[model samples]
Target chain A: MEKQQTDKRAAIMQAAMELIAEQGFHGTPTSQIAQRAGIGVGTIYRYFKDKDALIEVIHENVHGTFISTFTESYDPQLPVRENYLRIFSTLTRLFIANPYEIKFIEQFYNSPYGIAKKRADEIECDKPLFAFFGQGIQQQVVKDLPFEILLGLSLGPVLFLVRDHQNGFVNLNDQLIADIVSASWDAVKR
Target chain B: MEKQQTDKRAAIMQAAMELIAEQGFHGTPTSQIAQRAGIGVGTIYRYFKDKDALIEVIHENVHGTFISTFTESYDPQLPVRENYLRIFSTLTRLFIANPYEIKFIEQFYNSPYGIAKKRADEIECDKPLFAFFGQGIQQQVVKDLPFEILLGLSLGPVLFLVRDHQNGFVNLNDQLIADIVSASWDAVKR
Candidate 1:
């Protein structure tokens, strides 16, 4: 019974993700989400309190999957440069594999809901990804600037290029990917 | 009469920009824009055929402003380092000054409408700004990599940092800005 419940919840979330990713939150209505999920509208409330709650869950799932899947092989004991490249490559692969998630994330980050949460959490939210930056700084391998600046200059290039690629602005060939990794390393490395 | 027309158009565009920036296009309605502009709804039709046309105009205006204002003092005759620094600083300052436009632009680029037009123009979108990269390559001061790769590696950092600052995820400072420009130049410079 518990497994079935979990399955049902995942199904609903998947439906919401696809709908939100395609039509955006404003464009996708609750009834439409219910229809897409092959469930009744009332069933959605059983799993999520409302549309906003559902979206929040989607945010959690998307971010959770990224952290868990991307860092599954991350070993903190590695040298700074290796770990840094690992992180960059993992992110590039993640976005490349799931272009829809990038779109969903962009919408979430720019929306009022996402903005409020991000502002409240960004300064204090030092996830494992950020800890990598800290480790680099301790090893004298990364620039000694503020953490946010470090994040921006190093990871920003990859982030922007991936989004550009997803939007069909630039092609992400292997050579370009290699260059981007090297450039991002130079941006933050001492 | 011409001056009045221009002023009214500007007011409408400004209203639409603020609305679209704050809320995604799907979430913003034309009536709300009309009300915000303090004009009759019919007046919007006089200037714009529809919401899509208005948004296209906004795209053109935003890109035009960035290119024109940022390049106002750009001189190819300057040393490679000097010209590169100038370009970076100018872009940083412009985005910082107009946070609203940046938000609007992010929303625009991510939207379906924006994506369609951007993909169509992106291959041929090389402007004077991109020419700076070409010049650097010619002088052997920049990497000999593909120009698109050069762009992604260099300016992508600034683009990300400024957005982070606007989102309250990062605080921009003179020292940090200096570090960023140096790192970006390092990424591209030979």
Candidate 2:
């Protein structure tokens, strides 16, 4: 019974993520999510208090996995460029492997829901990554730009590339990821 | 009477852009747009067939202006880096000057409406910019990568930076734009 409950919850999340990613949040509703999940509306309510709660849960799940991949084997003692390349490769791979999740994340982060969540959570979600960039500036290994600009320079291209890869406009092979990461390093390195 | 008609049209466009930028397409209703514009919903129909038509007209107007800025003073014979810097400075300034238009553009581009419009229009919208990048590849001045990847590397950071600027997280001065554009050149230059 517990396993069945868990499976149903997973089904709800999968359906919600896919629908919301393809259609904007306002375009999707809980009834549609339940329909897509092959579950009853009551079942969805049992899993989540409301549509906003469900979306928040989805964001938490997706963002947690993403941040962990970024922080995997992270060592501040490592060269900033090296650390950046490592984070880049893993996060890129994660994004490639999970298009729906990344798409949902991209949309969410750009939407009001994501903005509110970000403010409430503050920068606590990626403290290590933020500190690593700060350390790079302190050590004079990275350009002395504001943290936000540095973030944009280092991560923006990969995010853009992932979108292209998802749209079938580009294939992100290992060699290409390596080259792109190197270019990202160039964008920030002093 | 004609001038009043023009003002009403402009008001509808402005209100629609702001509402759509802040609220996703589906979240906004024609009635709300009319209310925001201080006009009747029927007035909107006099100007547009429906909500979708209104959005499309807005997109056409905004995109046309944006592309013209990109192509202004553009010289194919100039160095790729020089042309890129010129284009970047102008576009960035335009975006900074008009946050609502850029936000609307960004959101629309990532939405289903944007995707469908892109496919129907193909790449016809930015032929000059596209050809310029192609010329760079042919001349061996730019990295030998897919056009999409090249676009991502060159323009993605600026887009990301603009969001930060909009969020009040970054102040993009002229010097910073120059530095960032230089870094963008580094990302794509061979």
Candidate 3:
């Protein structure tokens, strides 16, 4: 794509992300998304074949952004605890800062589109988190448990806590975050 | 209600559960549920004010079943660890035993219905679990963390693992369950 078209596509994606985050996939209309993007409906077609294709790209983009954010913060040379803490803290802060991304992920994970995407895609997303946990287990720094079990013990709570905070069921504070991190660390510490 | 009426209601709920589990809320119509129950379409209206009411009933049924199952096996006099172990194990086994119930819950939790239901409902939903955690925290048997956080740390893993197992992303063996319970205990232990 040319420079102008690339910018236009970016604009469309941002618009789609905003609308879908607010109204969900089924509730969103392509024309409304185009209007929000400041582009003609036909221009959307030029960038993507259909709404499903557009959604597919958006899902990939969101997942990719999460991976990049996590992978960037991770330092293998650092002590295992610091490295894992970096992964958790960076991802949690980014998620809180970008409610749109969080909303997009929550909605996608709940919908049939998200369910089908998981089944269709063989490649495991969040490979970086797994690698960190894998290293921790191998080094005997973390609990000698399966990677999946470790994730469920740690990130599982983080996921629920973020959701809880988002839904006004619980208040989030630095102290609470500290407590959670402490508990989560204990959960996997050897 | 008469015995026959009670039987009919149970039949309607079972039918609704099956269809909703298979096709989700939007895809399954009341008429289809009625047909599957071998009852008249008018009978559904007679029982439920609307589809939403029926769904609300289903949610209550599933939750009620979970609570009863947990409570039946619970002995308040047992050690805190034993009490919690029963909870984690009972809930996981129930979820695994009833794939339909799990599907119903996953779909419901991912919808506006689930979010709204959480807000509207009081603290009574998980009373047994809460009582156990409250006592543990009180006695300093568990960490002085919030009951909600402990739940998120413990049950959260069980929920994710069950969902993952259902999706065939991970296998749920006894050893994995034991490992998760151990980690969860570690997460909440003083």
Q: Provide the TM-score of chain B versus the true chain B for each model in turn.
A: 0.89, 0.91, 0.83
Q: lDDT by residue for model 1 over A1-190, one digit each (tens)?
A: 9998898898888888887777777878889988988888899999999889999988877877776776674779999998877777777878878877777877787777788776654544456657878888998999888887777776778887887787666788766777788777877889
The DockQ scores of all candidates, in the order shown, are 0.66, 0.67, 0.56
Candidate 3, residues A1-190: lDDT per residue as tens digits? 5899899999999999988887677667899999999999999999999988887898899887876776789898998898767677666677777878888776676666577677544235547667788888888989988777787777788888787778777776777777887788888889
**lDDT score for residue A41 of model 1:** 88
User: On TM-score, who's better, 1 or 3?
Assistant: 1
Location of the lowest summed lDDT over 10 successive residues in candidate 2 chain A: A117-126
Residue pairs in collision within model 3: none
| Candidate 2 colliding pairs | none
What fraction of the real A-B contacts shows up in model 1?
Answer: 0.75
Ranking by TM-score: 2, 1, 3
Task: Judging by TM-score against the true structure, name the best candidate.
Answer: 2
Order the numbered candidates by DockQ, best leading: 2, 1, 3
Considering the true interface contacts (CA pairs under 8 Å between chains A and B), give the fraction that model 3 also has.
0.59
Local distance difference test, each candidate: 0.80, 0.84, 0.80
| Residue range A61-124, candidate 2, lDDT tens digits | 9988877776775887788888888888887888899999988987887786687676544376
True contacts kept of each: 0.75, 0.59, 0.59
Residue B131 of model 3, lDDT score = 87
Per-residue lDDT of candidate 1, residues B65-184 (tens digit):
876776675898999899888878777878888987888888887776677767555544456657878888888888888776777776788888898887667788776777788888
lDDT per residue (tens digit) for residues B1-190 in model 2: 9999999999999999998888767667889999999999899989889888889999999988887777775888788889989887777788999899988987788787698676444376457767988999998998888777778887789888888788776899999998888888888888
What lDDT is obtained when candidate 1 is compared to the true structure? 0.80
* Candidate with more favorable, higher TM-score: 1 or 2: 2
